[model samples]
Target: VQAGQRLLIEGAAGNVGRKLIQLATAAGVTVVTTSSARDFDQCQRLGSQACYDYQSGFGDQLVRDEWTFDHVIDTSGRVALATNLDLLLLGGEVTLITAPKDDQFTFGVRAFYMAQKRINGFVISHATVDQLARAAEVLNQAFSAGQLLDDQVSQQHFSDAPRCHQWLEDGQDGHQRFVLLPD
Candidate 1:
């Protein structure tokens, strides 16, 4: 159990972020997430102890004021990778699902060396079938327990996939999730 472990999940409004939030909460871990201000309430409802808008300021002060997390998961590479490092307690672990590039990567490496931090790189596609099956079980339990949000999934016919993508690009569906329906 990851209970009592603090976790910082960046990009908490995205697909992985939303699922991560539910899983973390169900595990009794305290979660702190970052997203747009408009999604603050949603993130909070998803069980985040604190939610910050990544666009505002550097968010360094907020992170510093909050207790350092046991784990930091970066889903958005655009955010400050160095700051995320500073937010970890000694011996804490950081996992980058979407690794930053160029200067960002350079800085993160340097920080890891200097801080003696444990950094792990992750790719969701690399998850084993057994691992995914376990995650699915967790999700199923959460859904049954009413801990997961049922995001609206608008189904468009297979031929309408392009239109669905266009709608997503245009932000016409707000925060609703979408999927294609078999005709």
Candidate 2:
């Protein structure tokens, strides 16, 4: 993320999304993000200049607002890829951390070529151990510098892990993260 460039982050309330916001903001990039309306304030507090609800056709809204982005980092791939492709500036790129569930995606090839836009996908499970270690180190340094999020860390005993998963499945926690302490 170059200084003064603009970046849009999808799923800004997720773990990786929030980190991108913090890191990009620190790098002097303008950070705009998509999140539920309920998480807008939290996103702003993490340094997102604007937060749009992902369910509300945020990419279209941004286009209407005449906003263009240099890059996008999408964590919620299934519902976001098409719109993200539309939001890029010429020669822009998007990076996806997840794959669309149906394993199929369609886009206008002409438009993609005309804009010189590109998409990239990364699967953490497929990453080499050295890559994982480097990523860990970067995240750890960001945390130590207070440039990473630490909001709403709820703890439960290890026995409650099942319940924690259920809570996520039920969407009971908006942007909060749950930690399971050792028994």
- Which one wins on TM-score? 2
Cα distance off (Å), candidate 1, residue 121: 1.5
C-alpha displacement of 132 in model 1, angstroms? 2.5
Q: TM-score of each candidate?
A: 0.84, 0.88
lDDT per residue (tens digit) for residues 1-183 in model 2: 599999999889888888888888988999999988988998899899988899888878899888789898888874646777888899988888887665777888899899999888889889999999988988888878876757788999999999999988998886668878998
Q: What is the TM-score of candidate 1? A: 0.84
- Per-residue CA lDDT of model 1 for 72-176, tens digit only, reads 888887766667777877678888888675343434566567767787888879999999999888878887888666577777789988888888899887766
lDDT of 2 at 34: 92
True-structure lDDT of candidate 1: 0.80
lDDT of 1 at 158: 92
Model 2 / residue 21 / CA error / Å: 0.5
Please, what's the RMSD in Å of model 2? Answer: 2.0
Per-residue error at 165 for model 1, in Å? 1.2
